[model samples]
Target: MSVIDILVPAGDVRRMHLLVAERLAGKGHDVALVGTDAPGIARTLDNILHFERAALRIRLDSLLDAVPQPLLSLARSGAALRVDLTGSGRPVASPALAPRFAGSPSLAEAARLLMLGRLPDIAVVLDGGRPVAEASPMADSRLSVARGLDDILARVLTLLVIETHRYLDGGAMDARPAETAAPPKTPTSGQMVGTYMLSTVPRQIGGAARRLAFKLHRWNVQYRFHKGRRVADTGLMAGEPWLTLPDDGDRFYADPFPFEWNGRYFIFVEEFRHGGGKGVLSVAEVFRDGAPTVPRVILEEPYHLSYPQVFAHGGQIWMLPEGGAGGNLVLYRAESFPDRWVRHSVLVPGRQLFDSTLLEHDGRLWLFATERDGYGSASDMLVVYHAPALEGPWTPHQANPVRIDRAAARPGGRFVRVGDRLVLPVQDGTLEYGGALGLADLIELNETKVRLTEPVPILSPIRSTYPKIHTLNSSEHLETVDCIAPMLRGGLRRAG
Candidate 1:
């Protein structure tokens, strides 16, 4: 028992390590499966122990044979190792030299000891057989992923470092990381991860050397099956990295909302303004983007002030915005461009909900709601209040319908923090509309006393209409609409 060693870069091809050496020989442990397969399926399984050894051949002209073939056939079947480079149906052959360690010294410590103290802890990158990357080894010990890569590298590492700089989009690439978190809203050094793994490329990968040649086969399948998960007491460790978003503002961007004021960071979006009731509550000072000098207003309101809830407390800067014009929840106060702000006082009474996210936690100030019960097709609610502060005698956490879930329970935006834990960003609503980005986990903040130790769904349903179109000029009028849209199971099938 206790003898494992794996590193099959498309060398095995899909027996995926015989379901992991038949579940580690049913826990009696003793598996040792090296790469480059083709033999009668590793001598037909049993405590495993195969070592067929061959390594090298994913076609980049054999990539100098992706070097490394030592200790082949597991020391002639003596088996006393525990290494697994994941991806087991073979074909990856050189998934960037799989987690390295034919005698490893650094493929980021051989992809972080294969994956945190092993036992199939992870590294399952499959393909036609399913899985597609579960790599891990960007560490954060003061720093080391060779050096930064998709934050949550714990101690530091900024944005998607290595892993081919995660599909590239530094656009405003700032380093910042002096070990952050010391009043950086209680940061104390960076770390982020809530769920990751996405690659379908080609929608636009024809520049920058064919996007770095598909980013070297996407950084050897994201440095060997992407991994950085760490969340128990939430000492911070998670980042949802993904953003190629910038198709020249895709005819006027829409869903953006992500906040954390006073400490510095803001998004507050919704920007269409082409016609009808009009729209535009845009503001993007996230490391500074243009067109946001703080003056924007074109929200008339038959249905448009749209999903905003801004907050900063004590020093000022508070907002509640929703589709006003007598729909309710107004309150504003920036005086200059988080879009100038100003007006102040509306809080409750109309436009019941199209989006509203705000959380104060523990001492209490929660409100994560979503409505259109009128059959706009979506229903999710979680509202509770309790204020001796945040301006009000506020009260309403008598367990006021904390959930109704329309699939993954809507409400996606705002409420951020990883170390002290408290994160909300939800949305997996029954089907679409930015649906899939959940994570609630044992929340329990006081006041209206709310609870949640399970909300899961980390960013699902992505059919990509540039992130499931929430109406950014409706794809430029769709040919002036003449007919066609009545399909149900295959989507968009109308013709009226």
Candidate 2:
């Protein structure tokens, strides 16, 4: 264990500071809080956040919430000393110190980014002016700016703790140059307040209108055939003639995964009914010469389910449907083809794993999924687990969350192998869930590291009549995709 000092603004300590200190201590480190003499803009920011929350009707609790007085008092004393000491001689870190604000740099930078409609990048941690670690923090970007900032700060603090632990454990240091610790175009206090007040009210009103419309309309998936070419081979084009899967005004289908067996093609989807408000696994056969069959429910559970990733293994059909709400990653086997299923084994238990996708490479079975860690969007962090075989024992990668990126972390469909490269379909949820789709090449993978080439966007709402497309899959003769289609209330026409 090592001794570490965490720097914070004096008399303006937030829960994040305490959280960092606690996490360091949990990692068997002797941690101390070092107070620095810097003014805090938290009070002014909090006032603005308060008004925005009320205006937007946001009720979610965030880690940015104030600490209890008793805990605050205890943290200031008894091993948590808030003293005016710098140059501690021991290793030091700061979760709140960035390169922007005159007083509170990190928070000020966060506010500025939110105001500018940009997502926060990874926070760089420096030790003695050298970059030691980098953490890509994430939050739900769909919320109001104030709430987004709050959730981001919370995730940042947690990532800071993890990165610090990794650094002390002889983890690789970041080779990137450290950002200069100087404010450029720093806004004045009046400008910050004025900008938020003038900008957010109109946005809040527009968001309210959208939410009301969403209740009357709903999302439906779309599909198009690629003839002899795969959709992955030829990118989805704008204004292309596409067919919408029929929904009976009360139900919808999404997350399409296509598969071919015995010269027959089928599409699996997450079937969700309006009255039930929960999803179940369903499948429909596709005929090239005739109309597609109606989707039949294949699997259902008490909890919600989606993302029916199916494959044939050992002469048996295997299905790995996402059961995040059921609190585990389950494997199922078809007792009867297309309809009956039996529980095979639980690959991962006691975690909310979303959109679990599997890949086989180099004599190992790899599982990739985004974990819902009780905060932030589940579409940002990608965690990997590997096993020697299809079942039995699975081991998490040394770098569990190997990727932390909102734009490409979530798996949109099965890994597709093209020529000599393996490509992954990813969901770009930077602006909204399922707002776009892209393909990323898996450059490298091992026990300790995983790498992917930058995702090249293929389909987006801006380029098509559909508002969003998240899933992409293809069989030998057919290709399938799912998009968000807004339907009018009590009508079959598309919503305005």
Model 2 agreement with the true structure over 231-281: per-residue lDDT tens digits: 566554443456777877778888888788888778889998877968999
| Residues 123-239, model 1: lDDT tens digits | 221111222223222111111211111111210111011111221212222222223222211101111110000110121122234334321110000000112332212322133
Note the Cα lDDT for every prediction shown: 0.36, 0.70
- Report the Cα lDDT for residue 55, model 2: 69
Q: Which candidate is the best by TM-score?
A: 2
TM-score of 2: 0.85
Q: Could you give me the TM-score of model 1 versus the true structure?
A: 0.27
Top candidate on lDDT is: 2
**In lDDT terms, how accurate is model 2?**
0.70
